[model samples]
Target: MSNATNPTAEDAPPTTDEESVSVGTWLTVFGGVLGAFIAVLNIHITNASLKDIQGALSATLEEGSFISTAYLTAEVVIIPVTGWLAMVFGLRPYMLFNTVVFALTTLLCASAWSLESMLVFRTLAGLAGGTLIPLSFMLILTLLPPSKQAIGMGMFALTATQAPSIGPTLGGYLTEAFGWQSVFYLQIVPTGIMFLILFQGLKKTKPQLELLKNGDWFGILSMAVGLGAMIIVLEEGNRKDWLESDFILNGTLLAVTCLITFVVIELKRKDPFINLRLLARRNFLLSNLVGIILGLGLYGSVFIMPMFLAQIHGFNAMQIGLVMMWIGLPQLIVVPIVLRLMPHIDIRILLAFGAFIFGLSCLLNIHMTADYGHDHLIWPNIIRGLGMPFIMVPLNVIATAGLDKEDVGSASGLFNVLRNLGGAVGIAVLATFLSLRQQYHSSHIVENVSAYNPFTMERLQGFANHFGNLGADPILAQEQALRAIDAIARRESFIMAYNDCFYFMGAAFIVSLGFIALMKKPG
Candidate 1:
């Protein structure tokens, strides 16, 4: 028999027989990856249109904030449990049911009449859609052997790296061209296609109903509550002033208590809900650690870059989207090239190189001025785009190398959960850092600007004369000039704060290189 059927062949790669990986299997894997893409897409897509949606619903900024917050909390809570649920229900049926629920809930979001209604529908949508991510990851490990897993990893990378990048761009364009409701409506076509692909591509299998009898129900409950509360604390902490707010303080304690309990329970269980033991493997543990840095860089940059453009340059949603496309679009070309190179180079080396390049991209923005705008960001964003594909595919490969099929689900869940948790933490930390830094810079600059200083007096006169030429009375022109100087100082402080945020991210990436050093070559 040929090597295809000969498991004993010494030269054959140590995985499932590649020849048995049928076209239908490929379709199912890619289709599920697409589902994951849509799931992540929904997280950021609404952000661009949030203000418009708030206006339509007549909600204050704080109340309207729950719209995204609810979805994120629900999504993070569901990710860890997805793998075990898929096994119990059977992957095909479990996936199809969630897809339909995701589609229907998203549609309901378009019709929400108030902030309360939107939060309910968004949380439901998140619960249903969140299953797609880990399930797609599990399918990849189970269905493909080592030889072809790179292609599958490339597709999955798009969900992790590209979806967030494209989300605001797509959301902004849809809301501008069609309306804020169209952001919800945008899900219809993609979900329809995903449902059809999943239905046709997936092969039916009997549910393992007996596994339910042995399920770690206590572990599941603790994990759900703990992760949910943790997500809320991360996403809302900065806004609520962290421990200063009773709500945030309580949530933090609850998260710490429950997550610790969950870990203890899993450590002692015979078949844990998620096998935390996977972290004992050096490469798997190191990769997940690196995954945190990747998430921080990916989601943190996406969060900050758009805010900078909007706050500083006063760019509209469409203009911000146009600028972000540079980061999102170049990966399409880079992925194929990275895949080609993976066979020749050491995966660890490639990953480190990617991290190095990504660090450089962040550092490139550390010297921003008030004049920095669209043109200044393109190369850095493009460099970011290049670096991501290198890290994503190789990182996934190294993490899963030599993992058993039985353990794939737990590993996938842990890997995805940590990365997402990192993202939530990154955004909160970056926002807080920016705010505090801006205040520091603003105060320092203001201390130097006194009415007693001659240069300050001269600059005030220049502003006053300019406003006086615009027909303001002398007293009013002088007041306007003072305000203008303050505004300029505030603007300069903001630019410095933005530079500090970028510097922090770059330094974090460089620090992550130490963790990458611990991982072995992919088997």
Candidate 2:
């Protein structure tokens, strides 16, 4: 057997004689990963074109923002419960139904008549897309043995981790070349292909009718209300002014109350909607802790970099995408190499090295200046591309190392839920941090700009003179210079603030080096 298909030494790599994993198994795994890709890709793609979509729908920025927000809110709510859902409706039938519904919703989004209609279509689309993520994760573990699990997971992680990176770039080009609706339409070809592949490949298995018959309705409702409210608060918290907005304050309260109740109910229920008991295992908890931290770094960094370019350096969606590709394109090279090396190396060593490199990459970005461009980001990004697969792929495989086959599906769903929620929290907290720091830095810079300082007076005079030289009236030139000074001050403050944020992100992963040590090696 090829190294890629072989299991770990500890796993006593399964033989083809014992239970062969055929080519078709891997093929179906690929199909499922593609579904996961499109699900997440939609989140970033729609986000990239949200402004244009707003103009098309004639909605305000806040209303248009819900197009992406609603989809994700639905997605987070659905991810953890999907394992039970897959059990309720057999995996193959459930997946096929979701693919069809997701495709249909994409079409609805393309033809949406108004903002409200788009929100409905997008939310429904999320309901379907959310299933694809955990479903893909569940399929890989059940289909492949530990020895060969790396190959399957490497492929899945590549898509799940890298697809978000590619979405903004892909969406920008598609929307620019075609139109805003093209972002929704672009999924049609991929969805059609995914449907045909899974439909032909997956055999129908009888579902546990009992699981469906005794479905935990209360668990589902509380999970939805809790996860849904939390996602909304994260998505809109900054806009609503967090604690100051009654809507945000009340939503936060409800989210906390419902989520705590969800844990309590799931723990007491004999057959719960989510398998909360799985978290009691040490390896599972430790690995998930790492996953949550990785999620913050992964999604949080993806968000902050493009924002820096777009906000500070004036890069457009396409340009930002091009710059962001440095972080993603290298993963293609790294993931395959890591797959080959994984079985030979101590998985812990690989995880530690990856976490180290990943943290280094974040710290490297702390050197950003006002003039830093695409060239400035390459090495830091290259380090990140290489480091991430080390963490993401290994974590997935090693976390489930000791679980029974039946427990894998439930574990995968809850694992993914943490990462998704972590990403949401990371982005929200980072955004808030950026805003608060910018205000602080801007005020501090202004404090040093008084007339008592010769450098400050000289700089202000130079700006006025420069504007005056550009053929503006003296009064207009004076106003323009003052505005220019303020703008420059704010921009510098942002750069400093972003630098601090990168350092904080790096520290999280650096801390995860300790997390790597906490895990007991797979037996």
Candidate 3:
């Protein structure tokens, strides 16, 4: 079946036993999946500990934010290029080197004395760790035959669906019990185990150094600059007031120009480093489209929940983590069932069903009240847990179904890139929206609660009398009454705004069903 006329196929590794893949191949895939899980887990691990880290480093909230931003920006920039680099250096040595770098950088992040030092170390770590995600994806598709792909997809699901859900939980617990630094140091044992497993499992292949000369250097530069700038704009844009701030304005312009240049370069080049043409395939493109919404809901929900608990219910990190576990833990049981169901199911139906349930979970949160607490959140989180595996596992199979071996690397890179991009965009939109809605709700409440309203006056006088009963001076009690009213208004406004955010995410997920309709059923 080997075709000498097809250079791409010729370059592909020799076909292995399709019916019975070796144990080593499974082990290699396991290592890759584990690496991907670690990479993704790191993204959210710092979230629960950001305040502690900020205090320790003597950094402001805005300055501390860069710790996450640095990692995300570098990760987004490096992902698309990973496939090409792996090809050039050979996957074994390339992955091992990056793993080592990732391990070292983990230590560096732990030992960082200042925000600047942390950002540098984080960026380096992101560059190294980013490779794991796409490479793991490429490994599953290239190594496993169709029959076993469901199992592979199930394992990969843990990384995509489970990792984000579990990250805050783990980090919160660790920070509470051990300290903020433990979150970084936590990776050490896993990294070592991962290194050893990968070392043994992966068969060595010669580096295709000749491929370097043909590398799409211009495209690479454009993509890196473009993606990096885009991430910065999204992460910092709201806080910096979008295009109003000079930094955000300039970053937006740079991102636009560079990304446009990248697209033009990619489309024109015959042997582009990463194949942009794979998007022309219907299933691949549609799967990616749905994936954007997936990321939006996934990351956006995770970001919003902790803030919701902290602001409304006054939950600490550990308490928030405990509640969040409803979203994370059930997947262990659910994904196996999903894997079993995959054979008999039409994956398109499964994917759509998953999307629907996930959206339903968000919609369930739309009625959140000031009193909404841990018990009220459980069903929605568990529903989300069920829905995620259905979405993630099927979507992976659909996207990669008809792809050729040579194209898997590029496809993997593009697939991962879009999901991360979606996450960035989602976080930005939700953050901005939350602020705007809060203002809107607060203004409406303020306008309605005027002296002209008897009910408002009654409530105000009641509060004043209550404070006066606590032995405050008459004037002081009146002032305290006004402050209390304002606080109530503010709290209620925030609750409404948060409800709006949940509704927005739910609508996004439901709307994504249209894209799923466009996808061809997996063969």
Candidate 4:
């Protein structure tokens, strides 16, 4: 009998497959991780250097905020297209192109002479950077077995999560010692090293363009327009005083129209950009709900906390960064343990417990005082660190649990988009809420204290006496007393507003628990 036809030959005893890291695999992993780290690092680094960037560029606060929003917008806009792009271009070529683009963009950003030029370069960098995270995840899935995937994913998450927390610290030091441009220069070293590694070790993969033979160009365009418009409106809305300004009103109308049209078109399109049909699966739908709420909690509190530290607590960027280290270190330690235990635990229970713990952490913020120290945030941050691994990893698994191999990419894109959109919405809403609350509280305080009130007069007189004791002229003393009273009122107003923000964040987390509880339990 022929060897191929012989049953014994077909059923020959399997030899042990020794798992050793090939040079290529090591290069790919290192290059991919480094790229992802730099991308994530750049996002937060700018936060510490925003003041320097604004001063250097002679840009307004709103304009400086766009430095971040623009990059994020570009990143989100390109994310859904990654799967299609990979299919069209093949993985190695796509990665190569992205690396080159990212590197070149980093150069431009470092040398940019104007705000407009910097924003343009940032947008390009964001477009290239956006592909790294999802592609890295895909590469890990493709190469590693299911058992080993979590550990690999944990490492990737470490780069992603830890980089942002550490970024501000490094950026603050760099900006203080060198200049604002140093943050961009930091990207060059990693990008160059990654590019060299990728060039030598990456191999071309089979193109999967046949999957998109029935391409939904119209659906893609509609969704892009809709999502882009919505993001723009959200990001710019507070800056322009949402609905009060004609620009904001017009943008809102356009965003609403595009979104409604996109939703209708997607339901009918053969292959939608987001694939709304995935939501028909109960697990996918509920997982997205969980993602959105988790995002709201994560971004809203982080956004508020930094501002509070800088404005109220008189902390510098470095101090804020140091405080955030408390949050990052615990997460790094817990993630590995979580990955090891995930397979043995009931994910549904873990997710619910995590959501509850995260909610509790947000509640802790409600107790923050003007005199609060770094220790005040430590326990709550640790709870946050523990809660995140449970919420993030399981939700990712659950979101794609029912999807076929072919559907995984599209589902991941949509899920990530929702999470980002949730963050954008959370930040915008929180900022507006804080602004309005501050104004309302300030007005209430001012109204309650009048010239006729004994308390108000007593406080003013005490301030005037203190100013006089400082050797100020009578006129200057009175002026200093009035200024001091105003400052005190503003501080009190902000404190009240901060309390409201924390409560809102806590409630948001609790509401998310219901969604988490509803996620379909895996067999």
Candidate 5:
């Protein structure tokens, strides 16, 4: 039986029974899932390999972070344009083109010898990868009935929500066992298979040409520049010392001006790149607000945890990855259960409960010490795993619950763009916070020690003696003791910074709980 949504004039009449799905249908699902996974994974897998990439490319810490910031910055800029792009090119063709482009760029990234070359290709890859998330949702809405969308969306969430965490896990092992480049190479095989299946199994449908002709091209361009600039400022501001640098101050001002202008133009234009009318819906607007907060907490925590494990806990890349698997695995189990219970339960209550658990997880991190090990961090991650499905799946359902079919694409596009933007902001804010707190704590620790202080003298003498016993000269032992004291100060400073980050996350989660309370049940 054929499973076509649109029947042309020359098409054969349907049989008495509703059209049964063909083998091609399952093929399309697999293809779509694979494509979605590749797109999502690319955004995050490089995270664990950042240190290796930096060393290999001879890049500064700030320059190396661009590998992530550049990709996400490009992604947010493109996401809002997906609805208009789809209307111009159609779903099947657009997805196929994107898949091909992504594959080609991945190969380029793998072979890139210089940091500059890799950054260029990574941005290109991101432009293509950006469309997959929203388009995945659009396709699911088109193919499945509302009743079954929960399960299908749950499966998609496994890729979308879980990939950020899982990427580091897979990437850690690959980076440690092979090299950072291996992560890009691993995507080629899966994405190639997806391209073949999608090209074969999916039918093409052209978008309305009238809609394309009416789109505001200027608005789209402005929005892209505005968002891209804003993300750059956010990601790089701390490294440049924020407003102290002329570059950051000017970039921030330009971003704000352009973004505000884009909003005004879009609101006034007849056919904006993103349909602002969808935001008029209460649930749609509120759910997206929650999505932003969710992105902040989720990505912020994920971004910081690797630093904690590797720097403070002294774990290797592979060990960091294995520890993170404990978080991702439970989400897969929890998503299915949440899908089954969603219909019977109030989504707001579920979200609140999830926020509470998530906040509790953050609170756990606040108590972490310099002496804490892998076992000390495991339970909090597990609680985080349990809290995630409730926040993610339910909020998603609530976001699009009341939208008409025509609005689905725009709503999905807007929601995804905001989500990505939230993550970018979260990472930027946390990085800046971490840096400031580290310096503050380090200064405080240093001020508390003096040559005349008995405890300080005793510790320094003890360290000098320990070094002397290892066959060092007296002067060398004294210098070594100073170095040891400095190392201890830096370690304590990092611990304080991490604690501050966790406390901020907990507060964000509490704020989310308030927002969740405002969410009304789906009609």
Candidate 6:
């Protein structure tokens, strides 16, 4: 009963002959990609709105953080399974159902009366929405001929990369103007249109019910438990102080046990949920390694830049978006150029240059200071924009290009999962580094600011005099002056810590260059 043998018609992709490429094909791609776009975009659109959501629901900030965490947890867990789930449900019905569900969840999230309800809706949104990214990636393979794939992937990357860049800006404006509910509302129209377009042609893609009986339920359970537990740990680890906390300790143990169990179960299972067989291939393995690093850079920076802008630069979400746009818009020119070069050049060279450029850009930010703002970010971010497509498009092409048609689903799913997981891990690392480094920096700076030093004495006296002149009591003046100097020192320490983080982040990009080197260009 395992799908390893006796492949069914349902295992094959639905195809139209060369003679009659119908409008339905276009509509199908359009529907699927648009759904994918909105789904990916949703990951971040609600990002800038979380504070408002917390205020509206009267939930503590910790509870509000789960809105994104739950969504991402569901998303990462569901991504690898989507390929098989789609085939089991029939791609058309599966796609259509998820689109409707995702759209509905947006409405529910918008209307949620409490944090608990919002978490449920957001998780559902992730469950239904995460499938679209890898689903659409494989669909492009099925729907388009080899010649058109680069272009299809180009557009997909553009949407995936561009949407998150501006998500905060869009969320900011909507939350500022109409309230946080508007962020959820923002995607409804796009999702609705996606559903309507797919509703017509998707029925033609038949379901394979036999897959239901042969399904790897054990594998599924293991994956869900493993990934869900792991993501929760990563997302909350810093806040909970890592393995020291009971919650984090248990989560870590569960994650390790389940993931190890999942891998063993998968290796031995005859039609595994995720198709571990693909990882044996050299190109696929190398490409996925690159994917993880790229995700760390892309998602990690996306997380950090906004924190830098909103927390330090005093920018609103919209203003942060304005700067983030520099990282995305250049892709418009870069993608087309990368596509053109793919046939003529070796992909490894492109990847090396791209990775090097991105890493160098990270190094450039090591110069960040309290005064750095939009003007300081422009060229480095643009360089990052140009570097991204070269790395992503080539890596994606290399990953799936060598894969067999049937393997594309599993490979795509795995590729996306690693990338999403990378993002989560990257953010956790960034957050932890900032928190610990901030403390270390503050303490180290304070150690040198003692009034025993001439500079310290002068600075301390100046603050006390300024406060005394402003009508503070003598005792209160000294206290206020001390607090004021401490605040300045703390800010300076934070800036330096961020500078340190950039150097660490840049190291990730440099490491990726080795993976790119190891990937053999598909002959």
RMSD of each: 4.3, 4.5, 2.5, 5.7, 3.9, 2.3
Candidate 1 local lDDT, 450-473, one digit each (tens) = 999899999999999999999999
Report how far off residue 226 is in candidate 4 (Å): 2.2
Over 83-170, each residue of candidate 3 has an lDDT whose tens digit, in order, gives 8888777888888999999999988999998888999999999999999999888778777788888899889888987778878889
- Candidate 3 lowest-lDDT run of ten: 1-10
Model 5: lDDT to the true structure: 0.80
Q: Which segments of candidate 4 are over 4 A away from where they belong?
A: 1-33, 196-201, 206-214, 451-454
Model 3 CA RMSD to the hidden true structure, in angstroms: 2.5
TM-score of each: 0.96, 0.95, 0.97, 0.90, 0.92, 0.95
CA error at residue 222 for candidate 4, angstroms: 2.1
Q: Write the per-residue lDDT of candidate 5 for residues 1-523, one digit (tens) a residue.
A: 0011221111111122233434555466567767777888997887778888888888888888898887878788888887667766667778889998888888898788888988999899999988777777666555555665666567776776688778888998898889888999999999889888877766766655665555687788789889989999988898899999999999999899889988888788665667777778887888888888778888898888888988987888788877777778889789988988888888788878888888889889997888777788888999988998888877777887866666667777888888878888988899999998999998899898889889999999999999999999999999999999889888989988999999998898898877777777888
Which stretches of model 2 miss by more than 4 angstroms?
1-19
Clashes of each: 0, 3, 0, 0, 0, 0
Model 6 residue pairs with clashes: none
| Model 1 steric clash total | 0
| C-alpha lDDT of candidate 6 relative to the true structure | 0.83
Q: Judged by TM-score, which candidate is best?
A: 3
lDDT of 4 at 329: 77
Give each model's whole-structure lDDT: 0.87, 0.85, 0.88, 0.75, 0.80, 0.83
lDDT of 6 by residue, 228-256 (tens): 99999999999889988999999999999
lDDT value, candidate 1, whole model: 0.87
Candidates 1 and 5 compared: the better one by TM-score is 1
Please give the distance, in angstroms, between residue 43's alpha carbon in candidate 3 and its true position after superposition. 1.9
27-117, model 2: which lDDT tens digit per residue? 7778888999899889998888998999989999888878888999999888887777777667778889999999999999999999999
Order the candidate numbers by lDDT, best to worst. Answer: 3, 1, 2, 6, 5, 4
